[model samples]
Target: MNARDPQLPLQPDEASQIGAFAQAMWDEHIVPELTHYIAIPAKSPMFDADWEKNGHIDTVLRRAAQWVEQQKVAGLTLEVIRAPGRTPVIFFEIPATKAGSTDTVLLYGHLDKQPEFSGWRSDLGPWTPKYEDGKLYGRGGADDGYAVYAALTAILALDRQGIPRPRCVGLIETCEESGSFDLPLYIEQLGKRLGNVSLVVCLDSGAGDYDRLWLTTSLRGNVTGTLKVEVLTEGIHSGDNSGVAPSSFRIMRQLLDRLEDAKSGHLLPTDFHCEIPPERVVQAQTTADILGEEVYKRMPWACGGDGGPVLPVTTDPLQVLLNRTWRPTLSVTGVDGMPSISNAGNVLRPFTAFKLSLRLPPLVDGNEAALKLKALLEDNAPYNARVSFVPDGRAGAYGATGWNTPDIAPWLSGALESASQTHFGTPVGYIGQGGTIPLMGMLQKGFPKAQMMVCGVLGPKSNAHGPNEFLHVPYGKRLTAAVAQVIAAHP
Candidate 1:
């Protein structure tokens, strides 16, 4: 086989070969690497404060780098770049096989894992690897320790078949699960070394289903922080302080009322919301039609008193999709100054604190929202309590802004369509993800003309950041081939 012209689309036989190559690569190498990667608890910097001392992040980074180097792709140069007090990044570059091509395809993923959430099945654990029924069950494997492996495999598959491709670069970071706080610094340092980035392949977003290729069009911004309300200097007997001193929990609830409507679950502040673009609305409607009841039913709802599944906020598929993707929502992820039921006592706690995670619309400014959120929760405290809302991250980088993808170019759109049809036998699906990817927004600002192919294997019930998280191995194999096809078709 000879290297084909970069201008021509991949033929059916060529696509088949690419698919087979990807499958073989996954079976022979990638899956085993991910299995070992899953066993290491390389939690993100925020989750593991002692990441520098613990060295788990470095272990994963070094392993991935070693694996990439072992591949020995022609004209490849790899580096594990690091700075003081920051997580490391694996930066690798492959010169273009196509003559006179200057554009770069920046492939992005992360090796960091989320904290160990509860509720895994008996046989599955966050750090315990299990492969069952074509699903790699464990933390980080799907959300997305397999990204670097899949990315390199795609490149190798193309090279193996003598297919010409443009310059490709990989930026696999170790701080994404912590909102990618360290990425901006590295991106700035890499500046011109990143080349004229024309396409970004971010394999960190989600898929609505495992049937076909799904493109993420928009992502919600996030503002996380701790909101604490101190009503008393010290704990007191509940019997003595019931009427005299106000309960910190009660004051905390009152303060939260300023931000959210408890009954409707709506964010009371209008600044956090943004108008849903018409195109995105149309895409959401299409996705809703395809997904139907599964849009809401996919949630692991608890059983109701009547022995039926608990109802979601809404059953209308379009509304459910929009509510999650284009609306502002608040989640109190953790609480402090509360004792377990087994350790409960008749003493009023001195303070009440909550770890707040606020998701804003794609167009909203996360830092601005964070500032407003701080003022809203801390002002006019109930019973003159000492209340504060401290936003997460450093002073200037308190929140993570969301991303709205630019209009897809004709060549890229056709490539995506052809790749999806070739791999999954369906046209590409477009959907907006409710989760935030901080790097997407940063890249958009850095490379305004770049086409964002933000897709991933996080399909229905893959439960990332929660218990029993697994990577759909079959979907992953197809996705890898599909990615190679798209890259081959890149103009």
Candidate 2:
């Protein structure tokens, strides 16, 4: 069969063929591969410090590369690139089937997983693969383990129908969960090999719901660090020090007070905030109308003392969406210098340490915000108690910056609409994600003219980082087909 023209729109029959092929591929090949992938705890370098030594990252990388090689896609070339003291990346390229096309479509994903968080169902676990009711439940499978498989499947689906596509390249990195700290080095080394990137298909984002295709319009930046306060050299009897020495925990509170409003959960530093774009605000309102109260109701809130569900900060869907996507927030993820409640005693602890994670608005510079955060927490110490804030070195000196996508080209936008309507029976939806993806900002700067299609399968309740994380297999299949349709229509 002769390859179709790249400039042409995909016919209904071609789209159907792509969808069918994607569905069959997911059932026959991708699901089993993801099942094995979920079993391996290929944690990111940040969570697993000895990632290289542990070899889990390498195992997943090698396995994914082997799978790609086994596919035997025509004109495809693959390589597993590694650098000293960095996680490995699987880079693959397939020449354009369309004549005289130099534009490249970069498909991006990550193999690394977050640390195993608690609270799985009794019958499920982070490492135990369970495929029930069209959902693949486990770590990494949805968060991103399915990406490499889905990407290749999309291209193969197009090829199987002789639908023409531009040059396609895959960059599957193992350090994305670690803020993609090592990606800069690899990007620099690859340089011209990346070609003239005209489009990027990032599968490491989230979907608003499983009903339609969702495009991540923006991403929040992240700054994480440890804040420690010391008031004594050793533990002292509470009776002896309660009235005399300052409490380390109290000092810790005072330090954090300068950064956040305990009563309102708002970050006090104005520098951390940005003026939300008018377009994004309008989009948020539209999304709020579509999602309604599901925006806040989706959170797993705990019960209160009154036997009612603990309320969220707000119930307005617009505010909820804006707060998560465009607002800066502070979270104390971990604590130290305190004994467990079961082992508690009448001792005054020597120090208090908190692992602080700060989410910055899309326009805020993360590197500068990180530096400001270090200063805010360490500058003033009550009672001369020692205080310090050390940013996470794993993210490098320049912290992870948020991304605001460039304006969508008309052709690409039309393609998204067609793909969504064809595959999902709905139009494409746009929403900003609260999570950070460091690569998006880097790619925007590197390829200023590229159109980014950042979408994924982490729909409501899929829970990417938390326990009981799952990939909605039905959504994944549809999403893969949508990707192929869009690529075939790329010009």
TM-score of each: 0.99, 0.98
RMSD of each: 1.1, 1.2
Root-mean-square deviation of Cα positions for candidate 2 versus the true structure, in angstroms: 1.2
State the C-alpha lDDT per candidate: 0.92, 0.92
**Which portions of model 1 miss their true places by more than 4 Å?**
1-3
1-491, model 2: which lDDT tens digit per residue?
Answer: 24555566788888888999999999999999999999999999889988888999999999999999999999999999999888889999999988888899999999999989999999999999999999999999998999999999999998888888889999999988878888989999989999999999999999998999999999999998889999889999999779799889988888889989999999999999999999999999999999999998887889988998899899999999999999999999899998999999999999999989999999998899999888888885899889888887554544689999899999889989999999999999999999999989999999999999999998999998898999999999999999998898888
lDDT of 2: 0.92
Residue pairs in candidate 1 whose N, alpha carbon or C atoms collide under 3 angstroms: none
Residue 342 of candidate 1: its Cα lDDT? 95
